[model samples]
Each structure stands twice: as C-alpha cells, then as structure tokens.
Target: MSLIIIGSVAFDAIETPFGKTDKIVGGAATYASLAASYFCKNVKIVGVVGEDFHQNDIDTLNQHGIDTTGLQIKAGEKSFFWSGKYHNDMNSRDTLVTELNVLADFDPILPESYQDCEYLMLGNLAPQTQQTVIKRLKNRPKLIVLDTMNFWMDVALNDLLETLKLVDVLTINDEEARQLSGEYSLVKAAKKILTLGPKYLIIKKGEHGALLFHEDQVFSTPALPLAEVFDPTGAGDTFAGGFIGYLAKVGTINFNNMKNAIVFGSALASFCVEKFGTERIINLTEEEIAARVKEFVKLSSFNIA
Candidate 1:
C-alpha cells in the first residue's frame, strides 16, 4: 500500500515581511509529498507541471523516495505560477500574480501501481479535479483527506459539496468553516458540516491551533510558537501532508490516531514556516523531527496537583 497526493505542482514567487524570492519550486503536492516522505516510504505524487519546471526539483522529490511516474510534464508550455506579498503580520497577503498555465486543463491520470493506494491526500485544487481523482481510483482508499479553501466555496460550491461526500476527512480554516456551514460557533459549524459528508472535520486556526471534530468528540491541537516566521506559503499543505503521512505510517484510522496526526502535522508545519519554500523540511533529521514532536507534547501536557 502507498500514500498518494494529488494537487498542483508548479512555481511560486513569494514576498514576506522577512524577505522575498523570485520564483521557487512550490505547489500543494510539492509541500505535502515532501512532508509525507519523512513518514511514509512509499509516497507518490499526481500533478502536472510544464517545461518551465526544473528536472532538479523533480530529482529532489525522487531523492526523498517519492515516485514521479504520475507527474505529467507538458512540453512547450509554462507551469502554473503564483506571486503573493504578505503583510507585516505574516497572516494576510495580497496576490501579486496568478497564471494557471498548464493547470487550466489538468487531467489526473493514475498509474497502475498507484492502484494500491491505502491513503490519499487531496490537496487544495478545483473541486471537480479532486472529485475526478476519486472516481478514477480502482478501489476506495482506506482513508481520504480533502483540504480546500474559501475560494472553492465561493465559486464551485456545488462541486465542493459533492466532493465532500467522497472524502472521509475535510480540512479547512475557521473562516472557511463558517462560510461552509454558516455558523459562527465552531462547534455548531462542525455539527452542521458533518451532516453533508466527511466523518471528521478539522478546523485549522492558524496561530492558535487546529480542531478535529468527530461525532461529539473534539480534539484541539496546539500550534507551536515560533520566534521568526520567514514564510507561510506552504504551511497548510505541509500540515495536511504531515497529518496524512503519520496516519499512513501507523496504518490505522480512528479518532485517537487523528488527534496525534494533527500534532505530528503541526510539527512539520512549524518547520515549513521557519524558512522559505522547502528549506527547513527538506533537511530534517529523525532526531530533529522527534524533538519537534516532543515540543508539541510538552506544550500540551499538564497535570493537576
């Protein structure tokens, strides 16, 4: 069994309060697959890039034990590119540019080997694209986690709702949760969203933490406080990658494991923000990852006298 990640794999030019970059390797699958490679050995990516995407970057994924057979590189075309500048707070940003070149007509094609997918991470993309991937799968994965944003809800809501029904887990930020469920109270929002689809809903609260809702149970995972945040570009995708990667490693799916997965995912996300692009996550050691995860444990652990 393998873990499969499906989303955009393209270029990004980011400018933050700390610094700026011209164009670096980015995209949802790029972050998620790299984070997942640290946990799951058999990780594969399904995405489309253009001639502009470098082979060295593709080589990077292969070095991390990620399979790229499913990645389609179109000739005589440019890859999807995005440019954004973050505010002083490092939370809000303004879009400088967005060119959906090869991505405009992406067709998710699965390889025969990927048919044994036990875990699937559908990173943020068009709802119909995410849904198409699910339909193409030979057999239903043991678990399917879908991550989306307010953009989908604003435009392709019907498709997003239909895609929600095909996933076991749904991950969205607090504002998106409110928009999706039309309830201010997260608890109430979660209750209403659960009826639409998804056995579990994770409401991500950027700086504060993340909430996992399943039935009457809710698990809140704390976010690590960082001294400096160089970039926040791919943090959420890294979180989703780390989240699903941990679950695939443990080879189990349940409420208890989901809580722990959130912690593990948050740990990876903390690393993501330490530097731009995949700088921090790419060179992580097992001891370093273990220590980061321990920090989460200590941050949350307490006892009454």
Candidate 2:
C-alpha cells in the first residue's frame, strides 16, 4: 500500500536549552515521511522546495525508500524557513521567524502514480491546499488523516471546517481541539468535532501522550517518559507519520489496530526529541524501535481480574 503525504518541505532553525542549530532540514512532510518510512516502504511525498534546499536531504529521504517524484524544486525562489526557541518546559515555544517563501504560493500537483494512493496524510498546510490535493485525486484514498494547528483555526476556520468533512481522521493538539469545538472538555469536543466529519479524532497532549476518539469509544495512550527532551520540533508530525504508516502496513483501521498505531507513533516521537532536528529518527534501527515499543507496553499495561 502506498501513502501520500502533502505539506511543506523546508528549512528550520531551532534553539533549546541543550543547544541551537544554524539551519537544518525540517518540515511537516520531511519528518512525517521519515517516520512513516519505518513501517511503510511505499511512502510518497508531495511538496515544494527552493533551490536552497540541499540534495543531501533529498538523498536522505531516498535512502529510506521514499518516493520523491512529487517534490518540486523551484530555481529562483527560497524555501520556506522557520526559526523558533523552546521554553525550558519544552512544552511551549516562541516563533522567531517564519519565511513562507515558496510555501506561500504552494500548489500541490499529485503525480499520476500518486492518484491511486490508498493512504493520504495531509500534513499541516493551508486548508485550501489540502482540499485541492483531495479534489485532484482520481479516487478517494482509503484513509485520509489531517493535521492542523491553532493558526488555521484563528485565521481560516471556515476553510478548515469545509475540509474537515472530507477527511477520515483529524489530529490536533489539546488546545486546538478545544478551540475548534468551543468545548473545554475533550470528550465533548471530540463528540462535537466528529459531527463535523472525521470519524476519528486524535487529541495530542504532548508529554501526556495522546487520546484516540472514535464513535463512543476512547483510548488513551501515555507518552513514554523520557529522561530529557532535547528538542520537541517536528514531534507531532513524526507521530502522525508513525501512525498512518502502521495503519498502511497492517491494512486495517479497527480500534484495536489504531491503539497499536498510537503506540508506534509515540515510540517514534520519543526518539525524535532525543536529538536535535531529525538526527535521532534518521538513523533509528528496527531493534531500537522494538525496544521502545516494549517500554510503552510496560508503561501502560496491567492485568485485570
């Protein structure tokens, strides 16, 4: 099964208590594709990057067996760039810079081969752009997972709502969920949001882990307690990647399978924060991932009489 991921492929400059970086390859699609590649080999990315984007980064993606056919390279334009500094708690951050550059006018053009994708992941992008990709597809993907943030809710609520009706799942942070539904209670928010369209809602709570809501059922997966978090950049995108990748690999969407997918996603995201940018996730081994998953099981498992 092939998974299509659409979002920005850009540069990022990050600062944390441990250290800082000048500029590194980072973006929603970049992290998502890398994380997804671990579970699904047939991962295709659709994003645009300026000439400033490096060939080595592209090669990194290729090494993981990801298809870059839809990655557009613009000659004169600059790639999107974002710079941010994380607070000591590693839970909040201040945006230092955001240069939309090529991303400002991004128009996703799905390659012909991508038309038959069975799994679609619309990473954080403009709601209109996300909808465009959906409309362009010759056949609706078996599963469509959408990730968004408070920024869209604040600036483009109407557009976001319109696109919501077309997706199968929605992934957002706790705060974003509350804002989108105008309900402080997550259970209530999930119920209201489900009425908007997506049957599944994943409310990400950062260090607290994630919650999966579908119909009348709810599953909570706790975050792996790390000794330290180096940088939280791209963790959420990595989570989304691991999630959809697992589902694609298993070829099932039931609640039991989704619970396992959440664990896989959390395991991958735990590795993402151990090192700056995508360093840790890039070289992750199957054995390492398996060990991390075991830890998650131990953290959340208990026998019931």
lDDT leader: 2
TM-score of each: 0.99, 0.99
lDDT tens per residue, model 1, 189-284:
999999988999999998898999999999998899888889999999999999999999999899999999999999999999999998888899
The sequence of per-residue lDDT tens digits that candidate 2 reaches over residues 1-305 is 99999988999999999999999999999999999999999999999999999999999999999999999999999999999999999998999999999999999989998987999999999999999999999899999999999999999999999999999999999999999999999999999999999999999999999999999999999999989999999999999999999999999889999999999999999999999999999999999999999999999999999
**How high is the CA lDDT of each candidate model?**
0.95, 0.97
Clashes of 2: 0
* Model 1 CA lDDT for position 241: 96
For model 1, the superposed segments whose C-alpha errors exceed 4 Å read none
